[model samples]
Target chain A: MTKRAGRERAGRFLAEGAQAVREALRYGQVYEVFVTEIAAARNSELVDEARAADVPVSTVTDRAADGLSETVTPQGIVAVCELLDVSLDEALAEPKLVAVLVGVSDPGNAGTVTRVADAAGASAVIFAGDTVDPHNGKCVRASTGSVFHLPLARSRNITAVFDACRKAGLRLVAADGHAKTDLTRVDLSQPTAWVFGSEAHGLDPEVLDAVDDVVNVPIFGKAESLNLATAAAVCLYAGHLR
Target chain B: MTKRAGRERAGRFLAEGAQAVREALRYGQVYEVFVTEIAAARNSELVDEARAADVPVSTVTDRAADGLSETVTPQGIVAVCELLDVSLDEALAEPKLVAVLVGVSDPGNAGTVTRVADAAGASAVIFAGDTVDPHNGKCVRASTGSVFHLPLARSRNITAVFDACRKAGLRLVAADGHAKTDLTRVDLSQPTAWVFGSEAHGLDPEVLDAVDDVVNVPIFGKAESLNLATAAAVCLYAGHLR
Candidate 1:
């Protein structure tokens, strides 16, 4: 079953939809792929590419596809891509602008932030201890296939990441709803690292203490908080503008 | 059932989540509320406030709550609130700045635009002919309840909205990915309406043809397109700064 192959294997991760699988192929990360038999005649281009590239391909029924696809609207093509291995020691070596995601369990939000990091030219994005897996299919899709584009690393040892950032001489800016300073005023051009927490709760107090600065986006309405992806885009764009 | 009440009934739309239901009462919108008996006892503040406000309240089982909640994460509260009815004729009477959502189906995206509209201090937000219902629970929560604070109106006929803008000496600028002019250079200070379309498919060709001018955000990356909410926020923030 796809569920068994997708989750049980530590070396393998599933990617759903055409854009995601196409991106995996583009990035040379595909280990194996599956396309539901129903799409054999319809998705000729992908089938042709998979055949020409000599990537292992399989076909299954829609019922199997249902168990395989992460999204409600499946695009028929699903891929098993190699899990990327990244080390904090190496990421700190050339750090200019590093980003941290804390307790952000939503894979889509995590993926969009990674894409933003790539777009804004950040040095790296680290998924802190409690954040979602950066390689999840929804995140891969939201990044518009950006999962293969940048220096994004996941870390279970978040304290070590903070220590590494300090050693790298980067400013630690935590995005908070209660912070005093305006994010726009902070010098984003400086060697900086941004820390963001989950949507339900902002940064945990312990993690919040590890960062050097806390900043906020000035809100002028009744909305409780900005969507995490939107806020990430804003901060990343601010850096780009800088 | 909330499903049966879909978009047509205005006086009472389904307000899901404890947070949203609380906001509705705080904003004085709870005409009636229906929660599972457990839900009422779990969050008594909302139930108590409904009673103090002389609004009707009822209790049902968890299964009944499941039938009523649009979102999966229903925080034990579902409210029926009075809808705001702002007219284009009323809004464009003396326009300064405006935004229009053209056939945007995502309630969350629609809500962000509403919040940004208020944050950017736009005179109003116009939902063109076939947009998602503004009162959707996710939409309301995403707006952070800004939908209550913003001057938003759904137009039955959109051409009349444009005519009203013209009568008020307002300019209509359509945001296009392939537009010749850079949005950063455009004079957003004028009495204007910035228009955005659906995420997957853009504006209907007929709607695109009627706008006075087109503007594009400069792109420096390999991304196929920006998410609709991020694009809207970027443009609206620019207008907010202007």
Candidate 2:
């Protein structure tokens, strides 16, 4: 399940670390859990919980756990979980706030944004265009198990995703650094879907034009712009406040 | 310098990539710039700007640039620049807003918070307690040049730092997830210093008790909590809106 192809073929991914494994078990899609003796002892409650759920638990050597982990230091627990993403229609049903990532290739940024969206109570997160897979091990680890907390969707056709959101009564707004409209001026009390672009280059012109509005996060200091995840957090939290 | 001790003894740090090197040059403390031939061609204006400023520019092999970088893929440009930090008194002098990190060990989180604080127009960022050095290679890279744009101060004694903020007429507010006071209720319009803790363990009880007010960023979703940087961004940007 290390490679995207392998995960897609098997419809499963590895959730590393105690926090992720525990969340996976709660989501009720865990197939099996591999834990080292030390980890099993450290997370006795979690092991018991997995056993109660009838999920198979296996003890492995530290070396085996290390081989299964993507981090420099293995957390000694790993869970095999079924893919959690749903269709756009299902995810956007009655949505109030959504976060859309377009051409965001970095797994860490993708996962961080997902975690932020979840914290802000966003209804769903859509990985549009060439965005990284949420099931990627690094992305899963970065999310700290948020990948199991909410509805997620992946679509190659961003336009169709936007259509689906609009059909569900969401106003499409792109967060652009150079946009003339400031984020504070936008009426976020209404249902909205925020679109974020890659860290390297912002939203494509066509995508920006397709949105109902484009708002910029004001930069009050000398820094050029906000990081992608930082911008997403600020924007999502703003909507949450409303 | 890859090591913190070496950087401290020499009073110099390496700023890697075009954005960081450009910012270092603009800040007017660059001693030398080393760039690979390809990077120089790609960033000709940056090279010319360095030469015009009377700073030495050396063309190096890709291997040499790789040695100086902390990333998997080297951007092929590195600048040796003076350490940029000030005394706590100097940083807090006539401050209206500040971001304080206590016991934050992740260099990337530290740098990202610094960038977020900078974008929010914070007066300064203080690294209190046993925090990662702002001059660390990953921290610098993650900051993307914001380190040079704002005043920074580091101190081992977190109590003294809190006292300094209070003496400077700034209210000390810690971002605690479990605090009773919601972030929305805080009067951020006043001069305030926002305190944050490590990702693994939150603020110590003593630290929380010392703050003038402890506020929580309300998590409206199923997420257990927000990431360190995400919480910081939301808190800082909320203050920015005021």
Could you tell me how far off, in angstroms, the CA of residue A15 lies in candidate 2 after the best superposition? Answer: 2.6
Per-residue lDDT for A59-165 in model 2, tens only? 99999999888889999999999998999999998698899999999999999899888888889999999999989888887787888988999998999999999
Give candidate 2 regions above 4 Å deviation.
A36-38, A60-76, B35-42, B58-76
Global lDDT of each candidate:
0.75, 0.91
Worst 10 residues of 1 chain B by lDDT: B1-10
Q: By summed lDDT, which 10 consecutive residues of candidate 2 chain B come out lowest?
A: B233-242
Best by lDDT: 2
Instruction: Enumerate residue pairs that collide in model 1.
Output: A223-B144
Give interface RMSD, every candidate, in order.
2.8, 1.4
The CA lDDT at A142 in model 1 is 80
Candidate 1 lDDT, B21-49, residue by residue in tens:
77777874677888888788888987998
